[model samples]
Target chain A: MTFGQAILEALESLNGNKMRSGLTVLGIVIGVAAVIAMLAVGNGAQATITGSISDIGTNLLFVFSGGMEGGPRGGPGGGRSGNNDRPLTLGDAEAIADPFAAPSVELVAPVIQGNGALTFSGENTTTSISGITPAYFTVRNMQVAEGEVINEEHILGRMSVVVLGPETAVNLFGHADGIVGETIRIEGQPFRVIGVLVEKGGGAFGSEDNAAYVPFTTAQARLIKRGALDEVDVIFVQAISAEAVPLAVEEISNVIRARHRTPIGYDDFTVFTQQDFLSTFETITGVLTIFLGGIAGISLLVGGIGIMNIMLVSVTERTREIGLRKALGARKRDILLQFLTESSLLSLIGGIIGIMFGWFIAFVVGQVAAATGNDFVPVVGVDAILLSTGFSAVIGLFFGIYPASRAANLEPVEALRYE
Target chain B: MDRVIEARGLTKTYKMGEIEVHALRGVSFEIERGEVLSIMGPSGSGKSTMMNTLGCLDRPTSGEYILDGESVAEMTDDQLASVRNRKVGFVFQSFNLLSRLTALGNVELPLRYAGIAEGRREKARAALEAVGLQDRMTHRPYELSGGQQQRVAVARALVNNPAIIMADEPTGNLDSKVGREIMNLLLNLNKELGTTLIIVTHDPNIAAQTQRVIRLRDGELDPENNETIVRKK
Candidate 1:
């Protein structure tokens, strides 16, 4: 018989026991629906998590000075920074600024921090004085919401200038409009505020808006006393091109090592690019998605097995029909195809309903989350739907085999005699 | 002068647990077209076995059975089903019409299997009309009388336009008057279609009506192979 004919026949035969057929197909529907919903949700969470991480700044790289490994694990003194005998000083920072070797290198800053109590009017608040270059604004993509950032001339001429963070300007000046060209006292010294950073809602917890930026020359010459402790805290390198960050990091590490004349395995620093940071978040979120999907997959497996069991029962129940079909010139392949088609159709129908339900559920969850002020959205994409639907079809095909074969192999006479 | 049924050294042995019971001995015979042949036997005489083997439902143990210049004894299962669909139609005693279908649908089944195109419904209606069931075209099997169900089966058998109509005790379940009516229907079909008809029964009275009668006793052919096909194993 033709495929259309066989399909119609199979469907017509189901009406013989309507209730049983409905109940049996219900299991497949539930299974396909669950598989689609869980997979879409899992995929949605992965996209949201990764997008949030990337928003922080994929171009930002982090390097810490007091890292372990080469410093702590070394038998003797190794790198200049970690050793008690050798310290990372201004000279080591200067060597990484060889512009001829790294033409794309834009700015390099040596960072030093000191905390002091500030007195402006009756308010005495303590805050960290961050020493950085004028180019630090460019490196960090900071938008100025005031008069202007300190220029490169100010750093060279040792001019005393300051920039207020968003929260600091709000707290110190109490101007709801804007804080610009304002003076705030720092450690019994008066400094002119030149700029204010645009307000950025703080990440996770602590507010980045509550900090302040001042040129390194001013901080070293006027505010903090230069004691015998002239140790540099860290080095920030900005590449001229974002694509050069990895090579820049590699070369910077090498230049620092050469400048320090460090021994093997005792370097007290870690150099990492933005991609490393991104991958760290990727690993974490990827694992989370797979774990959740694995749990959902268990249920899918149970559903497939359930279908196999029901198909087996159907083969036995329809033994006479199978015999009659065989007697009417149906090939073995025809019988197999008929049973397989039924299973796949059941799964396909179930998956479509499940996908629609899942998308709606995910959308509702995103709306509720945004309502709660999280500002996060759930994303369900075409790839997830295709993956889940394809998997459902594969599950049906694999599980539909045994019963189809059994039906195809029955002896006509014995089947005809079935009670 | 085409012999529609010819068997040479046909044998069929059935295994019943640890013992082998011979269903048909080495017997041979032939029957021509348009003839009504009957096989009459007592119980355990292997008449059903012979009927099954002839119907391509079971293969003979060791034999040469030829039908219309084709070797049915060596045909594949699908080939046998093809022969059944194209050349042999069956009418059983209990009326093996599919119960889920209406009368029209039941008659259309064989043609459906044969992949017949449009107008199957009209043709099935015509078949039902011929069976004297035109008004009952939409009735299911359960709603039909015992005799009507058998008539639907007859319509199903003729729908494919096969060469022969094979009936196994066609009136065994009916009363004498109803049985006679069924017999008349079969004779009418033969007269109209000129189909070779084979009937198997235990009744000698039914056997006497056939143009030729073959009898089996204890799985062996009776002294009747002179005119009828006697299949033995």
Candidate 2:
């Protein structure tokens, strides 16, 4: 029989039982929707993680002297560089900051660190102190929410000045504005709060909003009490131009290594630009999203197997029809193609509806999330929608073959005689 | 004789799990074009086997059978199907109208196999009208009476304009009055269209109405050893 006739007949059968067909289609819809929705959320979370890591700019670089690995106690002895103690120092940052020395380099900031009990009106809490030069604010995108930023005078005089991050200011001083120009004690030494930092939002590790900043030299002298010989904790540097970042980093690394006198492989310190952190974060989030979405895609397999099962039932139910068509001169491929087309159509219709429904659901979820807080929830987009719908179609086309071929290959006499 | 169907030394043996049963044995016959032939026999006379062989729905175990210079013995099943679909049309005892399709749709079935598109609806309407089922074209098989359903089946058979019409008890499931009506429709096609027709039936009255009757008993022709076969009225 003509393929058109066969297809029309199959469609009529599907149309005859509307509810049953709709319910069958519903299976595919749910499968595709779940896949899209899960992928959207995963992508959203991944963007957030990567955004937090490199929001400052890829041209910015950081050198943290001590992380999980602890460095030497007292410096300028026999360090990993054979000049001793922890590797980096303020001199290395000053060396790179020299304009005529490396014109491609822009700003550099020395950093030191200490942690102790911070007190405000007898409300004591443990707080970390980050000692930073004046350029640290611009390099890390930290703005002064109130009062003045740490200036050269604070560093030169070794003044007891401090900047409170938004979270710390609110917790101790009651009002973020109240914290500016107030005195707080860190390890029983009083430091004047000169500025409050802008809110930097949450990150994978912790809230960037929670911390205190002070002049590098004052912090080094008062709290840390380390001499010029102590290894530098960190140095923040920004490239002279965004385009020149890679070259600038390479030159800085060369200059730093020459100062420390260390071989490349066993260098005691790590230097990486913000872009490196961003890409690393992106890779991590991408993998996490795929893993989550892959688990959600299991439903498609279940739905596809369901189609195969129903098709097998249909073949048995219409064995007589198969026989009649065979007797009327239908080719095997005609029958096969007819059944396959029917299955694919079923999935396509289901997928279309599912994508719309999934988007609606994701929108609703975003609305609910927005109600709770101001966080923007990620949702289904073109790629997710197309991928899911196409996935459903592929599932149908892929799984629909066996039963269709079985129906097509039936012996006319055998099928005719089947009760 | 302008022989359109010729059977020589035809034998069909069926295997039912190691027990062989002879269904048609050494039966030989020839039918010329435009002949109205009826096969008359009781149940188990192997008449159904002969009908199946004639329809090319089953193959012979040992035979030399030819249709219009083409040997049926060597023809593949697909080739046989092509011959059946093109050269012959079938009307079943049960009216076999595919219960789902209307009268016109049923009549349009063979045309579908023939790949006759472009105004097939008009052709199917015309064929149904020729069977006197023009008013009943929209009625499904169940909606139509037995006589009407048989007429629809008859229209399906004629729509292809095949070389021969094979009806296996065309009125087997009908009442006596409706049976006569269906038989009259068959007879009219034979008379008016001069179409070759073969029918299998146990009714002597129906067999007597045909131009020729071939009696089968126990898988062979009755009272016969190389008997003369001829058209009679």
Candidate 3:
């Protein structure tokens, strides 16, 4: 018989036991759906991390005072600056930005950050306040949605004009728009809002929107003046290009070491590039995705075995049919093809349904994340879809062979006598 | 008349755990094209084994068989299948219609196996009509009467126009009246289409209707009759 005719016969036989077929395919459906959903979650997290890191400026490195030990000091809400441990200063930032010192270094923005309660119109909210140079906006890709960004004049003159992050603008001024010229009190010091930053959403460093920006000179002279320590919390450095990151990191480390007169292996500072974090993140999520896929694959394997079990039962049940077909001139290959086709069709149908269900799961997850203020968008990779589908088909093929061969190898005379 | 089947000293033995059960022993027969014949025996007399050997379902342990001038003993399993498809048809006592397929679909089985693509449905319909089962074309086997199911089986046997039609106890499960009707149908096919019909049964009455009858006793030809074989004009 033609392969098409065998397939039609297979389908007809499967249709004869509709409930059994449905139950048999359920295992595959759950397995494939879990795989797809897991992949979606993994890819979505990777995309979100990549996007957030890119938002922090490409080819960038962060140099913070204090050693890599005991966690990151002078970080956000990190009280107690490393004043005794060779703290990074504004002078060091300038020296690193000098082309003669580090040619791979492109731009450096020194920042002194602290938390403050800003009061406006009798309403107050706690936010991180950072003193930065005019180059901070360009280096970090920060944009002003309204009014103008801090200029060199504001930095040199130690002006009190400030840029509010969108969230800060909305929190203090009750709205984000038309707040460019609003006056707000930072720790009882009056400051004029010059611009509101465009929203960039929440990420690894928490909401950038809840923060505020000011001129470095003003923050140094007036706000939280620590005498003689003259320390900046962190210095953001940009490399000339992505390829220059490692070179820039090495050069910056060398410059800081020489300038600090620190000995080898006893360095008091840590420099990390965005690439390092990206790769680390990728490894973590890649392993996680594989681990999840493996777990789901176990279920898929079980599903395949279930198919084999059912197929074996079916072959046994249809022994007489096999004999009858042989009597009707069906070759061994014909019987084998018919059973194989039936199993594959079962898996293919399950894969299709699982794909749709997985997509639905991802959509619901995305909606839930958004509802929880994460703004996370789940991405369903086409590779994941194709891989799972191809895997299931292979599973069906691999598992279907034994039973089909058993059916093919039946003795026609004995089989015809089977009750 | 062309010899549709030629066998010489066909022997088949079964070993039931160190005990040799000889199913057939030096049984030989030649059937002509378009001949109507019956193989008659009681249970355990090896008539079924003879039928299996004649149908090419099982190869003889030590003998030769030539079906339509092709060496059945030397052929591979695949070639045997091809020979079966091209030259042999089988009807079982159970009617052997696929329970899942409609009467028309069951009738189309041999043509499908023969890979006759065009005019398959029409030929199947005509075969069913020939068996007076044309109106039950879409009925499944379970929905049909035993007699109708048997007719469908007969139509399936004829659909590919095979050279030899082998029926094993064709009316063993049918009532006397339906069995007679089936016998008349087989006789009519032999007379009108010149199809070779071989029925294996224990019933002497059924064997009497055929032009030639061979009775087997304990894996050997019956010695009671002086006539080892019979021929008819």
Candidate 4:
């Protein structure tokens, strides 16, 4: 018989038992849908993380005053022992900023951070406060929505002026606008809000919108007096270009090592470029994506087995029908093709429906994530769709072999006699 | 007379789990074109085995059997299937119609297996009309009476215009009235189409309708009642 005739016969048989066929299709549907949805969610999470990391600023390097020997350091000022005692100071930031010493380093911002309770109009909230120079605004890609950012004049004069992040401004005065000139108390010290930073989304570190920025000299004199007088917590460095980052890192590392009087191998500092963080995160998220897809694939396998089970039952149930067909001069290949066509059609239909179902699941997940203030959008790539459909089809064919062969190998006389 | 089937020293041995059961032993017969024959024997008398071998459903262990000028005993499985498609048509006692198919679809099965794609529907329709089932072409088997279903089976057996038609207890499942109707339909088709007909049955009345009756005792032919009724042509 022709392939077309076999397909038609298969369709007729399947249509004759709609409930059984539907249930069998549903198994594959769940399997393919789970695979697609899981992969999309995993991909979306990876994209969100990497996108936020890239948003931190291009061609930038972070310099922390600690070696890599210690196990898993927390954010700055969580306290570390041993080689971490040597702190990065304002002098080191200035040295790295010098063009003659580090030509690839375009800018540097040394920062000292602390937590403080801010009160304005009887509304109180505790937030992180960072003492930063004017260069910090440029190096960290911070933009001002009103007034002006901390300038060299404010740093030299030790002015009690602060810049509020958009979220912080909203928390204090209930709005971001018209509050730039208002005065807010930080740890009972009255400081004028000279500027408000524009809304930048949350990042790998945390939401920059929830913090406050002050002049470096003011922070050193009024708050954060525990560390050495000129000690800074972290230094943000901007390279001339993305390609210049490695050279910039080398220059900064040499300058810091000379100033700290440490040898190359035993330097008490760690400098990392954005690429380093990106590669590390990519590896982690790639594994996570595979892990999720793998788990979903197990369900797909189970779906294939379900198809096999149903096909076997169908073969047995239609033993006499098979015998009749053989008696009607259907070749073994014809019977095999007929049953195989039925199973593959079942899986293919399930695969198409699963794709739509999976896409819907991913869309719902994205919507929910967005509602929770996350920038995650589930990514349903074409590769995922193709992989799932192709795999399911193969699964159907693989699982169908035994049953189809069983139907094909049946003796005409025996099958016809099988009441 | 043109010979349609020529069997010599036909033997069929079946192994029932290491116990050799010879279902057919040196049974031989010849059937001419347009001949009507009946195979009648009690249970365990090799009647079923003879029918199966004659229908080309099973190969003989030792014999030379030819059907419609093709040597069938030495043919491969696929070759035998091809021969069966083109040379032999079958009607079973249970109606053997696919429950899901309409009468027309059932009639078209043999033509489909014969690889006759184009004009299959027209041929099937003509066959159904010949069997007086033109009005029931769109009805499924369950919707038809036993006599009507058997007529549809006869139509299916005639669709491909095969060399021979084999009916195994074709009226076993029907009442006397329906059985007689089915028997008349088969005999009339043989008379009109000149197609060879072989019916395997235990009913003597059914055998009496045929031109010849071949009876078996155990695995061999029973010489007592074996006779060919000469038809006045």
Instruction: Give the TM-score of each candidate.
Output: 0.81, 0.90, 0.89, 0.95
Better of 1 and 2 by TM-score: 2
Kindly list the per-residue Cα lDDT of model 3 for residues A165-248, writing each as its tens digit: 999888887789997777899999999999999998876678888998999988888774643466788899989998999999
Model 2 spans > 4 angstroms off: A1-6, A66-85, A122-124, A225-230, A374-376, A379-381, B68-70, B223-233
Q: What value does DockQ give for candidate 4?
A: 0.80
Ranking by DockQ: 4, 3, 2, 1
Query: How far does residue A109 in candidate 4 sit from its true spot (Å)?
Result: 1.1
Comparing 3 with 4 on TM-score, the higher-scoring candidate is 4
| Model 1 stretches astray by more than 4 angstroms | A14-31, A56-58, A66-98, A109-134, A144-234, A264-267, B118-122, B138-143, B172-181, B202-209, B222-233
Model 4 lDDT per residue over A1-419, tens place: 78877888888888999999999999999999999999999999889889988988669998888777652332465434465357888899999999999999998999898899999979999899999999999988889999999999999999999999999999998999999789999999999999999999887778889999999999999977745678888899999999999899899999999998875487677888888888889999999999999999999999999999999999999999999888889999989999899999999988999999999999999999989988899999999999999999999999999999999999998999998
What tens-digit string does per-residue lDDT give for candidate 2 at A256-333? 777777655555566667777777778887888888778768887788888888778878988987777666666677
Tens-place lDDT digits, model 2, residues B1-233: 78879999889998899999998888888988888888987888899888878877767899888776678887776787777778777888877677767888878877777778888899888878888987898998889888888899888888877778889988889999999998999889888887789998888778777777888888888876222345463
After superposition, the stretches of candidate 3 with alpha carbons farther than 4 Å from their true spots are A66-85, A104-106, A115-127, A143-198, A212-228, A240-247, A264-267, B225-233
Task: Give per-residue lDDT, candidate 4, residue A418.
Answer: 94
Instruction: State the lDDT of candidate 1 residue by residue for A284-356, as single tens digits.
Output: 7678767766766676677677778878898998888777666555567777888887766556655676577
Interface RMSD of each: 2.1, 2.2, 1.0, 0.8
Task: Give the lowest summed-lDDT range of ten residues in model 4 chain A.
Answer: A71-80
In model 1, how large is the Cα lDDT of residue B191? 81
DockQ (model 1, Cα): 0.43
